[model samples]
Target: MTERIWKIGTRGSLLAMTQTRMVQELLAEIGVRSEAVILHTRGDQLKDKPLWKFGGKAVFVTEFEEKILSGEIDMAVHSAKDMPAKTPEGLVIGACLPRENPADVLVVRRGNDFFGGGGKEKRGEKKADPASGPRIGTSSLRREMQLREQFGLENVSPLRGNVPTRLEKLRTGQYDGVILAAAGLARLELDHEPDLVYHSMDAARYLPAAGQGIIAVECRKGGATEALLRHLNDRRTEVELAAERGFMYGIAAGCHEPVAAHAVLGEDGTLRMRVMKYGNGRCRYFSGEAPESRCALLAEELAGQVLAALRPAEEEEDHRTGSRRKDG
Candidate 1:
């Protein structure tokens, strides 16, 4: 009997290719041979445009999903973070590989002060003013707001491109610092660049994108492809991802919305999650934890809690403003 050969679909970007290769290797270990098929997605064509300006994160996975459904590829491998909250009908995430370090990291220009605001200090201590901080670059609105609110960094600019391009920009002095996923730098072996200094941000303070650092293999609802992909699923990663995606679904978050969520499975079998949402010129945080089996429900519950809390505050503010207007 001959082993089945699978065609794995992935984007052409270096990071995407790297992740795809990892999936291929995992399959090979299980005696399942596979070949990589590079697909140029709308996200790739519009690299220069901000994701929010056009199709949100959907642009990244749309073509690949189409290919899978059309049977052009047996499976699609993607960075889980790129996937949206809802899967198209007839498609399902067959597996989520073990996640990498989900924390965000700061890569600073070699000769510049590593921290944006001169150096790290107590929250309210004498520190370098925001005006004098080095310019930091990132595309995430969540990161931008967190930087300003938590680190007092006000000079963040929009940065687009893959990991290498972003690093090249920093190397050429296009910006003094850039924030990137630690897992990406590690996967590409770019974490040790001598020209840059690395600082791991605290996850509680710097919430990452939902499903960050995870590699996912998606397939149609039920078939040989999905059955084969079942071998690749990591239970812990799937549970954490379920919680994160459930929260995203609950909130109806689009790529443009300044929203971020991170979930982790602890040794005690508890799945804990932290989520952040920016609205009306302010940021709000929500958190919850539950057993792995109930992770998704826990996430949805937290989402409801956040919405319930926000509506009244918004109504009261509107009422106060209206009353002041009438008195004046």
Candidate 2:
């Protein structure tokens, strides 16, 4: 009897292909044969514009998703952060691979003294010029807002490209520094660049985007591919992703919303989650913990609280505007 080879769909980018190949290797270890089917997505084609301008992060997954729905592919691998808050109907995340470090990292060019002294400041060291702040490159509004509000960086510029291309830009001194996901740098083994200085952000202070650093395998609900993927799912990662994604959906956040959520499962079977929403030049945060079994509910409750807090401020602003109009 001949064995069947499953087709795993993935984006054409090096990072996407590398992640998909990791899944393929896992399947191979389990005695399942699989092959990578590279698919170029809309996000890949429209590199000149920001993602939100077209269709947000979903643009990256739509083509692979269509192929899966049409039965052209058995499953698709995706960077979990690139997925929308809500899964499309008829498809489900069958597996979430073990997560990598989710913290964001600042990658500074070799000669840039933005940090004053080798990615850190020394006592009495002169700070960089405030009028001409270092040009930091990033594509995410979440990161950009955090950079400005949290770190006081004022010269952030939009940078769009794959991981390697971004690195190339940094190498050429196109920008003084760039912000990138630590997980991607680790996976690509690009973190050891002698010409770059790395400063990792604290995940607690700088919350990661929901589902960041996770590799998700999406398959048709209740399909054979789903069954096969179950073996690869990391239970802890699945639970964490559930809580984080639950909060995202509860808030009705789109892919490009300046929102972040991260869930951690403790050894004591408790799930703790932190969520942040950045807007109007300010940031709102909500955090909660619950038994792992009830993590989803806790996330929903926290999201509701966040929304409730936001409504009063919005209503007050509207009321003041209306009163001024009537008086005029």
The residue-by-residue lDDT of candidate 1 on 172-272, one tens digit each, is 98888888999999999999988788888998778999988899899998988889889989989998888899999998888788888999899999988
- Per-model TM-score, in order, reads 0.91, 0.93
> 31 in model 2: Cα distance from truth in Å?
0.8
Badly placed stretches (over 4 Å) of model 1 are 1-3, 116-132, 313-328
Top candidate when judged by lDDT against the true structure: 2
lDDT (tens digit, per residue) of candidate 2 on 1-328: 9899999999888899899999999999999999999888889999998888899999998888889999999999999999887888999999999999989998887776475463333211233674476778888988887777777786778899999999999889888889899999999999999988888888988888999999999999996889999999999999999898889899899877889998999999999888899744588888889998899899999899878978888788889999999999
- Candidate 1 achieves a global lDDT of 0.86
What C-alpha lDDT, on a 0 to 100 scale, does residue 211 get in candidate 1?
A: 89
Please give the clash total of every predicted structure, in order: 0, 0
lDDT of each: 0.86, 0.88
Clashing pairs in 1: none
